[model samples]
Target chain A: MADSVDTGRPAPRTSTHSLVVEAIENRILSGELGVGDMLPPERQLAEQLGVSRAAAREAIRVLESHGVLESHVGSGARAGTFITSMPTAALSRFLKLHVSLNNFDLDEVVQTRLILEVESAAMAARRQDPEILQRMGEELAAMDDTDLDREDFGDADTRFHVALARGGGNRLFADMTQAIRESLRAPLLDGYRAHEDWSGLRETLQHQHRELLAAVAAGDAERASQLAAEHIHTSYQVLPADSGGSRRQGNRTAAGGV
Target chain B: MADSVDTGRPAPRTSTHSLVVEAIENRILSGELGVGDMLPPERQLAEQLGVSRAAAREAIRVLESHGVLESHVGSGARAGTFITSMPTAALSRFLKLHVSLNNFDLDEVVQTRLILEVESAAMAARRQDPEILQRMGEELAAMDDTDLDREDFGDADTRFHVALARGGGNRLFADMTQAIRESLRAPLLDGYRAHEDWSGLRETLQHQHRELLAAVAAGDAERASQLAAEHIHTSYQVLPADSGGSRRQGNRTAAGGV
Candidate 1:
């Protein structure tokens, strides 16, 4: 497998580690390698690619960080680097960090979420999956706990949206939805803590959740989509601005309602 | 800054490097560390966090892979790891690998793209930005070239959609659109190459692009959205399947249409 890599002409200025990384990535992209496939050991890979073991090790570390490769210790069948399928957590972490760095504006993030969740809710309603409905119901019940604090309620809220996304029966959409919701977790929690009237807002939010669930249960796709959008818009109206003006200000100026 | 880490009780099995990674991630998420803020030197960070220098270095590598940090070498004001804002290529790379791994089904990816681009088209129409429109026009002209090969046309096609996305005036939405389009580039190119009647399909695609651009130029949000959806649906119909049945087959089985 290593002999297939073209090493006749090394590109000038490119690091040996990067070349190895690109060679491995090309194999994966070409469908030559896949999940659960173990890669050559550092020494073997270094020899095969005509690079140093340190370069091979660095490449492994980079791939491991991307959640594309998993390293196992010990001398056993499984004690090697294997291609892994772990997109959800990795995507969430990537989006969360970029969001924290302010690479994406808060309003744009919220708007993107509105687009995804609204579509997800509609699809979920159309599918009407009982298992997903049950999971969402459980989250709704948890959110209704009288003694639940802001942080706990926020977590349950995230779960509810995640469940709805999964119910749509589209893994890609669900993963993106999950990542966006999780990325906003910290800021949303801050907003919840700063609310002037937590009880009133909580009741309103709970009521909306119940209605949205009912829409899904009844297989009312249009209503579910509309309700999801309105819920998000209303929720954003109350959340405080993280940096500049509140999202409510931007929403009013933006064209096309929800 | 390192003194703020909660290192009172480290999990027995968790690696020290992971703990360091989490500490820095927490500081960023909490807004204590913004973009452009340089992290302490590896030695100092290790000492402050009560971890080995090797662990700190590993943590830095992980963050750098995620596009959250950049390392500058040599001795100068810029010679250190600083938080950076560069999530586009990183995101595209992640999505491409996962798509290649089949973690996300092709139909699901297409569906997600539809949800995003349809809204993007409408938003672009509503915004009607002159510069974005000019960019889209240039891409359209490039695609009109009779001598263009499959590869060049595909690249221009990707650029056209990317321009429409940027015209939507939502950075988050545009970035997601760009990443999704780029991730599907190879498969789409393959499908383009395998077609028995390239010119016929090319004409149809170019005509559809013209109509979509006209809708956007006219500021007809509904028309632009409908055109965008129809264009994607039509284009996907002609593309060959990577595995299993074609996307057209899956679309026929799936409920609801854009």
Candidate 2:
């Protein structure tokens, strides 16, 4: 197992800034430091840690990028760096890049999505909360309206699935599910745009959403799961084949295509 | 849906350094910049990007932390910064921190693992790759042997599961599954150490592993999935009551508790 901290510097490796960042990160992870807690002044931290100011500043810069730290502009107390809770955006960015880099293929992405959504749908069925369910209903309603565009439908569709994931009562899983689903928004929309029969596809999706909502509301876990899996498979079957391919091969951020 | 890039501001609302970094990151993600490509020299980049050398340097440092860019030390052809790929370690670190910060709760973590591992276990069974199977078999045998320490058994046990995750065709899922499982390594070992009947627990796990392997060998997807789920659930049941809860209260980093 990897150690909590890389304690063994077997050889001259990483860099001074990296090591400094790790040290501070360990403290945050260990709860010695916490959200809202201010870090020592750069010079003080450097002196205490026996590192140069440049190293300390670089470490701070790293943490700042990760959203683990925030800097306030002022003199005294508000001036220093403070620990901050990273929002889901950080996770989204990381996962997006990872996927774009071919860290996971389209098949893998689809399969992973299937597994998460199936379980999430099942859980949502078992513990259907009215508030969240209502939100989902709104998404379905939005899709059904005559003036709704494909992009709008796509965004609503994402929110609908995300609501189901959140209903599953797992934060990490929900965030991941949200990330994956959101990442596919552009590509899925591109496929939707390319569809010759938009009304037919929209009708099918609407029917599926209604069925899914009914299952969840009725607390039918098995039916919810089955519908969810079917919904995903049927929808993807209609997606433009080229849109599902790696968008990273060209000079477009996956987001642009989405 | 959020736009690909925030081009509203000529520069970002915050530090110029951060804006430069975000722009570069956006470029990289968009595939405008590919691996092995060299970045412009600091002075030229700063001037072209309408930022200072200090800001350019800071941007480089931030990207370096994420393993997106690397800088050379010597005054040679390779002395400039270049885009590079990061190993799964960077992803793991991001996930671990997010987990620690309660970006996702216990239920989320468990469900995410369930999604990844169940699929992975089923695939591993179907593939029946000799090397992975052999590694898993070693762990199973180690668990069965009475003289093995709790720590050793736990380590082996993690390996068995990790091997199964890697067997899945999806590297991203495997990397994520391995990272989440590894994060729990310390706590699982602590639970093993605290067990009143270590032999009994080991016996149970061994039986589960064998059954899981048998399912995989026979290409019984349903059985492999069921076995994997039960294995995780039973192991969680045996863990100390405080195992998951202890994380939020404190003890973020491993202090060698087990």
Candidate 3:
């Protein structure tokens, strides 16, 4: 069993800046600090943490990059670092690079997506939110344009999935769904551009989207879930076999091809 | 549909450091940079990107935090920033802060967990690796200790779940499952400590864990998924109502109580 209580005490092995990072994280996790709350100035933080100003600055930079904190420079109480919430962008960026780096295999990613999106589609169907439904339809319509480039079509495709995720009425699920879809955007577009049977593949995807949307609109949770799973499976199958093979081989070769 | 093709060019609205960050991210995503590839020196990078040294340094800090790069200091060929792959820790840290800050509600988190773990449990059941099964049994046995404290039991509980996740044989799913479980470690322990009838709650959890493990061991995917879902629901039901309510209220009050 992994240790449950971290105690928030920096171990001797941890770096100085990382210790500062953990100290701040402990505060945030323990609720001593919170969103919209400004952090102390670099000097004060350094003094309080008994670390150099450079270490504190590095820690702040790390937190800022994670979307947990935002720093504003100027001369005022509001100008220092303030806790912020922007997980979606940060999560997307993290997942994208990891996925690109082959830290998570393609099959694993696709399976995870299937698990999340199938449930999300079912939940969205149960909710039957008209606004989200409309957004999905609009994305479908945008994809129907025959003259649209592969990149544009991929954007519409991503938006359609994102809309379905949002329709589930769960921000966490929606954010994750969005992140995964966005992370795969480039590779999916590459798949589209590489396919010899572009028109046929596009028709297949469009038809699946229409059917999936209809299931959601009709509030058939089971049908929506099944369709979502099938749609994802079919979509991924169209990608070149080498696209998601490995970090060194697949991504490197695919990058050159693009 | 949002723009899909991020042409590596920096937009006028983007900050100098952010532009540098994106430029590097583009290379990583495009597979131009792979693991173990060293980045140019800060001065040279800044010169090449037409940005200040400070900008390059800040960008490196951001990328390093994202687990895309690692920096080493000293006067040697090996001492430089190199692309790295360590998404597990970085991803966990991001999710923990976001969950702590109430960006994702407890209900949403539990629901997401149910979706992931249920699928994960089913996958594990299908795989049925004896080694993983044995590890899970050991964790359950550890939890069987009547004298175990709330913290120790919590750690055992987390390990049991982690074992189940690993059994699924999907790195992405396992990593996410671990992150979510670890993120809620403190809150779960607090819940355990605060419960009026600790013994009764422990008995219920142990029973559920046994049943779930049996389902997995028998390779009954459907039953395993159902049991996993039920276990999660019953477990979270024991947590206080405000355990996951909001950042300012739920966590702050709970922190004080703990």
Candidate 4:
């Protein structure tokens, strides 16, 4: 019988550390190595894979960073490394970086933010709790402060949207909503800084925030969704058109270099 | 500095590796670790932190797995580790695994998918090029083949939706759409096999697909978005209402284990 056609490509002429790292990731993703499964001893695994112990050790470290594996300090068999399962924060950080890389343009990001926040606002309107609404109120109050700097106002604005998303009562939606919104913080601040009418802009934003919070508080799903979408689109429209915010940032930089 | 006050805790036994990982992540999130910056050398970093070389090496490996670090190997001073960015796929994988760990329930997944796909379909209707529309048509055709197995049909179904997202002309929206849809592949297939009326269900799905494509082809954004949302909701409604189709599989396994 033919040898399973070697599903992996031949390792490039790189360090052995790279090869070992890839092998371990393959095993984890393919489900051959699952959560809570103890890895074989380091020396034995190194021997089986025909690599050095240093390479195997490096592979362990890589997986540990991704939260794919955990190790305890001990001797004997119990000291072996085991697979771990972590929260989506690891993934969220990865996405945040990708967004910063300008793989997607500003228009695209704005459009996406429109979709997510509109949906989140609608859901929040329909199923919001008192605590979340109170949080939105606080953020609005902070934005209304006349002494607030552009940076502080921008931070408050971000918090307000994040609160609205959390009020939607869906963790996945809330997390993605927060991630995408937070990803825009830098650019939004840049826009705010470039504005000569910072006070006027802050006043306008605060007005919108109060209206949106009231709509959501009253469970006005249709109104809330429309307002959220309009707010996002309008903000993007108002930003300085000359500066290419997307391209000026880092480019490419995919997680795996793809 | 009063020796940092220790809070009267048990000697503050945190590992040096863990501390390094957090510090690095903090820098990245705060925009200090921009792409193309070189990380401190392993030996130098170890001494700077007052930690062993092994700890520093481990921290480096972890960041590498998250796609935050890349390395160059050379005989001279040119060799060093570099900070890098990751791709959306990495985030998607993290989201998928997070969902698997029950961080978000099945209903949340379904609802999030509905919100994303509907907006994506609407965008695709307005912006998709002829080539993208053609690829979507091909995916639909693949699903129409009666001889296709459940796996291939599910894959084709996913591709059809993914193609629509890609055509939406918004990279962030498309990435989010693709991630949610791709994550649903396994559970959706499992749900498909659980139904007794497989042939009838398949026919219904095919009809919906045809209707959706027709709507897209006609450039009816409103109709396409509405149809896509209904399509997603209808599928979930068909699945066993208990804990979704996967729950049944899980219960059976639990009973067998007992």
Leading candidate by lDDT: 3
Please provide, for model 4 over B1-258, each residue's C-alpha lDDT reduced to its tens digit, 9 standing for 90 to 100: 112122311122266776777677666656566666787888998888788888887777667666566666554544687776544454555555555544555667777677678877776777657988899899998888999998899888888888887776666666666667666666677678898888998999889988988888888999999999878866765544443323122221211011
Every model's DockQ, to 2 decimals? 0.38, 0.32, 0.41, 0.27
Q: Looking at model 2, give its docking quality level.
A: acceptable
Q: For residues B1-258, could you state the per-residue lDDT of candidate 3 as single tens digits?
A: 011113321112256788899899988888788877899999999999999987788788778778788776666766787887777667778888898888876667777778889888998998899998999999999999999998899889988998998898877778888888878776787788889999999999999999999999999999999999889877876676666535534322211011
Interface RMSD of each: 9.2, 8.4, 8.6, 9.5
Better of 2 and 3 by lDDT: 3
Per-prediction TM-score, chain B alone: 0.87, 0.77, 0.83, 0.73
Give candidate 2 misplaced runs (Cα > 4 Å). A1-13, A75-80, A244-258, B1-13, B41-44, B70-72, B75-80, B138-152, B244-258
Among these predictions, the greatest DockQ belongs to 3
The C-alpha RMSD of each candidate to the native structure, in angstroms, is: 6.7, 6.6, 6.4, 8.0
TM-score of 1: 0.88
lDDT of 1 at B201: 89
Candidate 1 per-residue C-alpha lDDT over B1-258 given as tens digits, one digit per residue, 9 for 90 to 100: 111113321113266777898999988887788876899999999999999886787788778778787776667776787877667777888888888777776677778889889999999999899998999999999999989999999899989998999898777777787888888887787788888989998999999999999999999999999999999998777555544222122332342352
lDDT of 4 by residue, A34-117 (tens): 655788889998998899897888777665655466665667654567766544345455555555444555556566567668
Backbone collision tally, model 4: 4
Sorted by TM-score (best first), the order is 1, 3, 2, 4
TM-score of the A chain in model 1: 0.87
Kindly give the stretch of ten consecutive residues in candidate 4 chain B with the minimal lDDT sum. Answer: B249-258
TM-score of each: 0.88, 0.83, 0.86, 0.73
